[model samples]
Target: MASTAASASPPPAGWASDPGVSAPLRHVRAIIADHLTHGPTDPTLAQRRAWRDALYDAIALPPDVVSTPVRDGAVRGLWQSSPGARHDHVLLYIHGGGYEIGSVRSWRVISAVLARRMGVRAFSVDYPLAPEAHFPAPVDNVVAAYRWLLAQGIGAHDIVFAGDSSGGGLTAAALLQLRMLGLPEPAGALLISPWLDLTNSGKSIDDPPGYDPFNPRAGLESFAHDYLAGHPATDPLASPLFGDLHGLPPLLIQVGGDEALLDDSVRFARRAGSEQVAVTMQVWPHMFHEFQAWAPDLPAASAAMDDAATFLDRALADAR
Candidate 1:
């Protein structure tokens, strides 16, 4: 999602003439820049959602993929799977809207495409959002969803957790919560441009060196304020970058080099590595936040998804 002019930062260096930049990439950047520049400064929730959905409206699911609504306990989400997807393994995806704006509908395209690529059943969670639910509610909801999956006869080892932006942060938080609750860890987790620091302390937030048209520091701070809702920003669960990550499963963190949250992934990867967790981090040059959502339209997006599939295959190979 993007911010209004009220929260937008000065545009970063444009990539129009950068070496190796593609025509499609330049066009995508222009589209995002124009959209954010012309957006309402005080958009209502409905307006924000519509804006987001329209941005990716052109991206479509494969014809063979099916999206079915399902509810188990507190978990409400869509079950998406393609023809060759394995029924037994689960890919539990949490969408990113800084814990405020995104929904199952807005994220269905990416979720469906990922399920198709990974050859697994995907359950994209519709967790409670902020300025309403706030703080630990989202984390609690995700943990409950994982438990519901287990109750449905899915093995913990056969499940892989994946999410983008704040959802990526929540993925880490839920893994920590799972550890505290004595629940088994999943095979691995994939985090895309994760906003893991509610404190907004990452150096990149203040000093970005590349082009990131979407997520600005002021916008991220506003989101943190609403999501944290008076809670301490440094609380490990709220900002999983502050958590103990020792026993979590293997992690593959893919972040855009130019996004404000780049440091969140770098710092978390450093901490996770120091804690002896198997963590792989990739930084895509000249890219912005959640760029993977662009998929086939953006070469980097497709490559990022391909890397994810490889990571998952390696993680799930033991079970196979």
Candidate 2:
């Protein structure tokens, strides 16, 4: 087992000790923490891309997994743990990076874990980012990727969509767009601390300072504006919070209690529940948005992953 303190920096303010994380993840978290502390002053665009790819490789997922290019020549990922009878189900993963960062390579570890747990192959799309690729671009790319998946003989009913933060928002928007286009819906959707409201209308945004460790309120507000770039924030596709939840697939939302986006998840859950969508919202206390990505070593982080796995299992079974 790796030492918890081997690579760890002091816990951020308000973080309590957790015991659910594996030793390997603890080592990973420590390395990430060190990077966070003294690595780069300001990362350039190329550097960010390199960093994203490096983080993915650091997860050290199996080398035997294969990847293929998708729409716009972006890479689409596939991971299968040791050969077995292939399952009919699939998971299409869209990664989070505030719509300006993140890629399939950066989320390989997460995809691998989901693939192992769900007994299904996981596919991650490397969608275009913002500031260069603006509103509707990323969403359009995801839609194209899904269509590509369908073209590959995968049934929509056997697919589940999952993403974190901004990517989660994209997942919901993509589903809505699919419905609009008369395409078949996926079996289920999973959101991790989704940034559903680019408008930042979630009531939780009103919380006092020092509440969320990872996300500074002002920084997120800035990110929203930068990503939207003069577009209307209330557009249902941009902010799923204002969209119609009717006829959407069952959804599982996991959010941290202290996240600024907490209200976004809560409000979405309430609306989805009212619309008779099978919705489960799990809130972990004192954790920041996307805490699992930052502290994969913590017990809470692993528990969150377990929660996601269980949700996927039940939802996929029901879909079957």
TM-score of 1: 0.94
lDDT of 1 by residue, 16-51 (tens): 445577787887777676666666666787687677
TM-score of each: 0.94, 0.83
Q: Which stretches of candidate 2 lie over 4 Å from their true place?
A: 1-33, 48-57, 62-82, 85-87, 206-211, 294-296
Strongest candidate by lDDT: 1
Candidate 2, which ten residues in sequence have the lowest lDDT sum? Answer: 1-10
Q: List ranges where model 1 is wrong by over 4 Å.
A: 1-3, 6-20
RMSD, candidate 2, Å: 5.7
Q: What clash count does candidate 1 reach?
A: 0
Give per-residue lDDT, candidate 2, residue 4: 18
lDDT of 2 at 51: 52
